[model samples]
Target: MGIRLSSVILIAASVGLLSNCSGIRLRQPLRSTEYDWRLFGGSETRTNAAPQFLEPPLKLVWSYDASAGFGPSALSAKDSVLFIATLQGELQVISIKDGERLGWVSLGSAIASAPVVDGTTVIVATADEKNNVISYDFSSARKYWKRTAGPVESAPLSVGRLIIIATLNGTLLALDRDTGEERWSIQVSQPIRSSPASDGERVFFGCDDGAVRGVNAITGNLLWTARTGAAVFANPIVIDSLVIVGSLDSTVYAFHVQSGEIAWKYRTSGMVYAPAAGFEHRAVVGTAHGDLLCLDTRTGRLLWSALGGDAGGVINAAPLIVGNIVYVGTLDKQLYALELSDGALRWQTELPGRMKTSPAVFGKRLFIPVENRIVLCYRSTSGEE
Candidate 1:
């Protein structure tokens, strides 16, 4: 199916504005402590890394009941508040310390991905039959503004003045964070189910068309595009100068950001959907066949593989690596904690439903959302649910 020509023209105009420069800049050095992780993957880059917390087998502080049904990942912000956009389309902000419902805004549409926050504004992309993006004030529970778009399956990313979103129609949009106005958009072939990434100067995302494209963070111009063997569904990760992304072709790729050249590609027995967790020269990840593998990021050489129990044939979430431990969830309804260095099993926790979302580790707890519609809090200590 082709995207509407009108939408194509709209995106082209916005990207053209990037040539003007003098748009937005981060004043101080970009710090992880400032922004709230309102989306499925964490941050605008979707790094999904929280260096503050030790890996799971930690401890569950508390678990709260979500007013709406399951969608994807829940939002964990900085103010000890957890924002959840339910399948029913209501946005709820809760106290992370106690799971208390602080406030809620009814969007009257289904939210597919986790909402992202910029300053006091919480932005949510609705997958309603109407297809719109809405912003709400986290502090006051008021509607900020709303704009129509294609079906947004990927999570939204916020840089400075621009909020980047990837849609199922195979386009990336840059919108004004303050006014909800269009800034620019870039078109790609195939659908975009994976979230986009930013490194202050460029935006990167993967698509079902078997390619990963990088665009100017300022101008929306295509900076580089790299081909993969199959579709990509996970958000890409940017660390230093390297861009790491995964593909359904059973491989994890490491690419050179500035040159658009392949650094390495690690193959697995099953399809891969989530980005790899990197620590210095090594990277760790899981496969759809239920095996967790650690590889050399520079050479794509496998270091170790731990065969997990037969739960299902696919792994959807990225592994969370903290210090010496790597945590991963499988379609088998199991969450496993393996040794990061050797892929040894430390402990495993089972939930009532299949596990598709990555675990959110904060403080000493792992916030795991199961497919059965229950948001579970597991203590890293005993691996108890």
Candidate 2:
């Protein structure tokens, strides 16, 4: 067996973006005040769908220098503050209104994913040997509890009073939000690179064993599992009654949320490292070949596909659906906003460096991290911050 061209490209891209952020300052900017995006996914269900719409012709509001490297994950917004973590385990808090640094807290040796913000409490997973998971209260700047799980590469999903964490060792564990104790645990015996998503009842994630598994979030009981052609590295999106997931085999599978039956599957030109961000029956996603596609969730039909950027820069970040717009950031240093109805390109811009993470929209403001070092905020030219 030989290394594939995609693997070579991914390795090169990863080496280019790996920095951490530290140092902080308090700012006198207005805050979002709303806890819009507290989890890695957009909603409580981990749908990756935005409730509000952001039209194009957006203006750059501000950009903050984090001076650190970031992972391939989405940003979390809550309570007028935005939280981002670096590979070096520095969690930097920024004010959403002005892109000002609120403060900084070093949580672990390395943070592999985004931090989950619940009110003043932040739950983050790290590569620390002693404290892989930590829950801290930001209001008083005090550490609440820390637990040594394992290497957790995915962001923790907040479900009710439990914080769901999937580890590289294939152990799905849920922690109590208040005490950091184990709520439930299950061993699937496979690596879990994909973050867990919920449909209010069951939690779904992709496994390295070429399968997508759904378990009860509260009980940790395995409900059902569906097979794929390759390992699933992208996060699963729960849309409508379907659990949409993409695989390294260049195929996307939609499983019935309740029974785990195959609903529909579609093949792309390249691998699917990016997850789907869907609205209602329409699913918008990006492929590793730099193709942006919109698929019919009910029938697996391709509504439209548009390939953009330079030489199809491999896309690893998840797509964000905001009203009539679908925003995606690619590793080719390009950010795009397309029309959700027809896959028409609406707006495009180049970043300072390659972007491997996804975008988050709170109210009318859009937040995207570029090259794992800088955080950029944008809004409609007519919209106020």
Candidate 3:
């Protein structure tokens, strides 16, 4: 059978079987040098850039059936374990090496935000009527604490001892990572659906009111707020002295990290929904009109743009930059790997469903969570093909 046909059959059979059984249990030890994807954008800055690169012709290594379809929440990895949250209110821990189900926790509510893995603690936010931010001890497989926040659709930000979350009720809350105790809360003018990006000192997030605000991480005081032409749904990526974000108005804005001053702005042909990923002097972003753009980080000048062609769908998931390759998944159930220097298509493949979350890369493997209840793994076989 063809690879796509086999993948569909495997996914169908695995989902039918795994839905009846409890999660898989594996005791594989983590590697010392393995990188951890602790946050939504891979760091407090939300750059969405991988530390290591994997070459083209990535071969399928393994696939895990999530049983239930995944939400917009992204996957997090630590050592060799992958933490995945599903729309069925389940948080699953899977072994990355062999795609074995390790363990899982049922949160009893839908999760739309990525889980944050910090050491042995895993933090996640749910989207129930009264949204909750729960912390779990992965080592003991027990709940640490559950705190109620507003309706949170954005992923929680774990910085040092604080857990930061933005709620749809226009609240930005900081809680103690260990105790789930509220440290501070600041109310913005409109709902905040974007995750907060931090640079250790201040936390940056965008609101539906077309404003991006920065608050002091320690005091919860509003430091500054910058306005855009439309609602800002994408997370802000902080690099150096600039805070970069995309808006629904089809514009990308860079604000001064400290002063909230507009450093530069770049206009695209479509509304921008994905977080911008930066590497070296360039920042890359994807748009709703199926356009991928690379811009000079310092000047906001368009370096190059690539059209996703006829099959390219809306690029909602953030683009992940690893070495010379830029990986992005589209709503059309296609994954594209573009050359970093120029937006040239190097490799593209059709997935089982839409890829709603950004992919995670560590060592030689790429982990992609699809909307079809399958997590696909690919290993780098760069020069072999």
Candidate 4:
């Protein structure tokens, strides 16, 4: 069966079935190769920046079908490999250069979120029929450990030796990186959809209860909580002292990382599904109403906006900002390139189905996942310069 894209997000948030076991411990921060792009938006800063492709049209180089359901956002390493988790509980490692299938490993459960990798291990928080978190060693391709928690549709975040995640049951769990052991689990008033974001000393995450919360990363202590207008399904982006998150209320809210006070709120016509992409003084975000908007990061002022076809789609996935171009996909099954400076269309490509996963860019290659149960790799027609 195909993934229930529209119903999947809602069901994942309403069902909190926290039941399962798994084990790991890396106290002093296991010394592995640098996992530069660990979070949903690449870095904690969520810059979404990579070198630009030369001014040329892009073409599909190769395609890999997971043949299960939808795939999550593809993650890339400086080493030039793409990592992805599937709804069928499969993990795949592919070469970014030629889209060669390097390796495929099964974790034995459905993985709804992107896998976070650090050093030798790739941590995937999956939802079994029983609901639990499973950690694995990507290098050895072995099950390292597992931890029982509520249903996790959101991806887990790794900060040093700690992994932070949320559940539909209104529980926020902190797991030790090495041991897969629970650091702590804080109970919130309502269910959570926003994945956690870390700024070293503290963790910032969003919840469906219309609250954006901050918790102490080390002690799992509640730092502060601020309420928004409606459920918050989008992930928050942390830029130095500012925390940016979007809500179903059709608005983007920025808060002080320490005080949790509203720095500014930018209103949109439709629900904002992803965090704002910040570059220089501007931040870019897409609306469920099919409009791409750019706002000033400091004051939340509108810099520019562009309208696209509804395509019966929402901007659920975060956009990839390469140089001056912003790349994003829609339920319309179209990949769009917009000028970051003015929100103008650069080019658009059609895919077979809806694209729930964000684009992963490395050098000149763009790897995108479509709900048609296939992952595609495209390169600029002129090739990498």
Q: TM-score winner among the candidates?
A: 3
C-alpha local distance difference test of each model? 0.68, 0.79, 0.81, 0.71
Write out the backbone clash pairs for model 3.
Answer: 24-101
Model 2 agreement with the true structure over 111-196: per-residue lDDT tens digits: 87888877557788997656789886654456678897788888888888988999887889989999999989989878888999
Clashes of 3: 1
Task: Please give each candidate's TM-score.
Answer: 0.84, 0.90, 0.90, 0.86
Please report how far candidate 2 places residue 367 from its true position, in Å: 0.9
Better of 1 and 3 by lDDT: 3
Residue range 75-191, candidate 3, lDDT tens digits: 887666778888887888776777877667677688887798876678889887553788866544456788889778898998889999899889999999889999999987788
TM-score of 2: 0.90
Candidate closer to the true structure by lDDT (higher is better), 1 or 4: 4
lDDT for each residue of candidate 4 in 1-385, tens digit (9 for 90 to 100):
1111011000011111222322121222322223345546676555565545434367888898776674345454434566677888776665555666656666667777778776767778777634367766644445677778877777788776888878878888888989978888899888777778877788888888899999888999898999899999887877647888889999998899898999999889899877667676777888888777888888989999876454435776777777778888887787888888887788888888887776666555667888877888777777333
**lDDT ranking of the models:** 3, 2, 4, 1
Q: Pairs clashing in candidate 1?
A: 14-184, 18-219, 38-115, 57-380, 57-381, 58-380, 58-381, 59-379, 59-380, 60-379
Report per-prediction Cα RMSD to one decimal: 10.7, 9.2, 5.9, 8.3
Best by lDDT: 3
TM-score of 1: 0.84
